[model samples]
Target: MPDGLILPIANQKDYIRAALEAGKHVLSEKPVAKNLEEAHELITCDTETDWRKNPVHQGGFLLDGGVHYVAGLRRLLESQPSSKVCRLSSFTTLLQSHLPPVDTINAILKLESGVSGTYQQSVGTSLTGSEWTVGYEHGVVSVAGSKVVVTVAGNTEVNIIEDERTGVPPVVRIWAEAIAAGITVKDLEPEEALADLEVLELMLRSGESDGLSMSCQYQHIVSNPN
Candidate 1:
């Protein structure tokens, strides 16, 4: 047996328990569960070590597969080893030909750091779409699929670059280096992932609560790690 499987399951607790019982880690796709509590219940881990204090929280669609943007912001504010912090001032959802759940996720993210972002993902295909821009202290970094463009302060023209398997290989390389160094690396620890889920849950709640701005305060996963 493969220790664990990634097929869809109705219950989050059962799914996570099965993976843990088989002594395997899981990388599940989006729409994890009915709610944040169920999502937390699914992920089981040892609490003695307190891995939540780990220095890194990797996230961002371009940077870390959109896993831990909030943690990255925290690291950036603390002047940790990473790129400069950028403010996501305004985000717009140009396309809305998607499910109500997708629209629900578009709201409810208000960072204390003044970084605002919007989830504009859509299921319907479109020939023309809005591009994503990340503004930093030094300059701006923009990416559309494989095409990458960077505009710096001193530089006059935008610089462009491309490479096959660009983002995927870098992620794989990082994992390999960590493992080779005898470091047991978990992809976005259970607690950290749960925190992110809590935020997503807040987003859903905002939609359900008639656009009431909400604060995500659920720390259950960190407190009661399975």
Candidate 2:
């Protein structure tokens, strides 16, 4: 497939490796890999264990769909490690009978960029369309349904995107455009994504295992992206 894109639907590590070996770029789903070991295998590079601090809060959004949100926030701010720190404080609760081992979570994340926010997530709640709200120092931008609401300074504004598909976001379109223009997609590169995976895995470890529970309960299972 010349002049084509390889979108890896699942079996992420193998698919991504094949695409890269074939000289193609990949846009993979979140979490990158099943676990830190598998993720490292996908990267084919040595990643360091550099912890900024000890565990402050530790928990998971079921099987770490938290990765998606965390990755978004990091990319939105172009988060760089070794200088920027993400401190996570997490608490878990069980509300549904058939939920993941760790279902509900509330996390307070303080980024070194002076961006502090709370993420509340649950597999126990009613499933609505996904919503992402980014708050910068100036104001905030929130996307709900097909509408984007921006509140900055002393004013509020809303823009409705006609015929928008929730599953395909503008970011994907930007990626495609960059590829078409023969420009490098910097942030979504494999190495850059590995950085996100590193932080997310650390956060998951700290929050889920309390930085100590891996001895007995670290069962590796393929996560359902529901």
Best by lDDT: 2
Q: Would you estimate the TM-scores of all the predictions? A: 0.56, 0.62
Q: Per-model C-alpha lDDT, please?
A: 0.44, 0.56
Which parts of model 2 are misplaced by more than 4 Å? 2-11, 22-25, 45-65, 79-85, 127-140, 167-182, 210-226
* CA deviation > 4 Å runs, candidate 1: 1-6, 25-34, 44-105, 124-131, 154-182, 218-226
Q: Candidate 2 lDDT, tens digit per residue, 108-171?
A: 6666555666666677788745577887679998977677899999699999978655444765
Clashing pairs in 2: 58-207, 59-207, 59-208
How close to the true structure is residue 169 of candidate 1, measured as C-alpha lDDT?
58
lDDT of 2: 0.56
